[model samples]
Target: MGTYETAATLDFVVDAVPGLSSTTLGWILVILAAAFEFLGVIGLKKYSEHKTLFNGFIYLLGFGGAFAWLYFSFEYLQVSVAYAVWIGIGTAGAVIINMLFFGESKSVGRIASVLLIVIGVVGLKFVS
Candidate 1:
C-alpha cells in the first residue's frame, strides 16, 4: 500500500477504538516514545563510530519520533510525570541492553539502581 493509504488506515483504526481514554493513549504514546529513545541512543552510538549519513539519518529519525510521541503523551499525562517516566524507561532499557549485549558491568549496584528506576516509574504511574 501507498504511504498515504497506510497512514489513513492507521488513523481510521485509531479513531475507531471505542471509548479509549486520553490517559491510556498517553501512556501508550509515552511507552512507545521511550522505546524510540532507546533506538535513538543506539543509533547515536553507531553514528558516532561510523559518521555515516545513513546512521545519522537513523539517529535523527529515532530522536524525532521519540520527542513527537512524548509530546503527544502530554495530552493525557502530567508533563513532569510523563517526562520522568520516559527518561526512566529509556535509561533502564539502555542499561539492560548494554549489560546484555556489550558485556557492560552487571554489578549488584547497577542492577539495583535499574530496579529502583523501574519501581519509581511504576509508582509514579500508580500515583498519577
Candidate 2:
C-alpha cells in the first residue's frame, strides 16, 4: 500500500460513521463538486481565449463542493474506504454529470470504463 492507503487504513478504525443527515449531505456535496468540476473543465476549454465570470464561479463552486466532501469523507468516513469510494463514486458520478450537463455520449466505450472502475472498487477488499 502507498502512503495514502496506509494513512487511510490507520484512520478507518478511529473515525465514526457520520449520521444520516451528514451522509446524505456529504453525497450531495460530492455530486455537486463533481458536476461543477466538469463544468469548470468544459468552461476552461470554451473560455480559453477570455475568462468569464460564470467560469470563475464554476471553479469556485467546484472547489467548494469538493472541499466540503473531502472534509467529511476524510474526517467522518476515514481514509481507506473514503479514498477508494471517492475516486470510484466521483468518477461514476462524473460520467453521469457529463451526460446531463454536456449531453456527452455514454456509449459502450464510456460505459465500459465506468464498469471497470466499479470492478476495481469491488476488488479493493481483496487487497486490503
Candidate 3:
C-alpha cells in the first residue's frame, strides 16, 4: 500500500492548485482527481501491450490525486452531503465526457439523464 503522507502526494496537490479558496479548491481537487481517474482507467489500453514507467507513475499518481481529493473534500464540505454532491457531479461529468470524448451515444434520453443528474445535484444544494 502506498503511504498517504508521502512527500510526492503532498507535492502533487501543491503543484496542481498552489492555493485556492476552501470551497473552490475542494471542487477543483475533486474534479482533477476524477479526471485523473478517467485517464488512468483509459490507460489500461496500453497496459496489456506496452507498459512504460511513465504510465505506471500516472496510475500511482491518479490514486494519490484521488486520495488528496477526498482529503480536501471532507475538509471543506460535510462528508455525507459533499459525497452526495460529488456523486452527482461525477456522474454528469462522466456522461458528458463519454458523449463528447468517447464518442458514445447522447440522444435525448442521454441528455435527459444528464438533466436528471443535475437535478439530483441541485437537490443537495437545497439541503443543509
Q: Pick the candidate with the highest lDDT.
A: 1
Query: lDDT by residue for model 1 over 1-128, one digit each (tens)?
Result: 65642121123334778977667878888999998888887788789889999999889988999998898777678999999999999999989877986678999999999999999999999999
Measured on C-alpha atoms, candidate 2 has an lDDT of: 0.59
lDDT of 2 at 32: 54
Between candidates 2 and 3, which one is better according to TM-score? Answer: 3
The lDDT for every candidate, in the order shown, is 0.85, 0.59, 0.66
The reply for model 2, stretches above 4 Å from the true place, is 1-50, 119-128
Give per-residue lDDT, candidate 2, residue 70: 60
Worst lDDT window (10 residues) for model 2?
5-14
Ranking by lDDT: 1, 3, 2
Residue 2 lDDT in candidate 1: 50
Per-model clash counts, in order, read 0, 0, 0
In model 1, which range of ten residues has the least summed lDDT? 4-13
Winning model by TM-score: 1
Off by over 4 Å in 1: 1-15
Candidate 3: tens digits of C-alpha lDDT, residues 9-127 = 23345457657556665556566656665655444434544688877776667656666676666655677777777667766876787688668897999999899989987887677
Q: Which ten residues in a row have the lowest lDDT in candidate 3?
A: 6-15
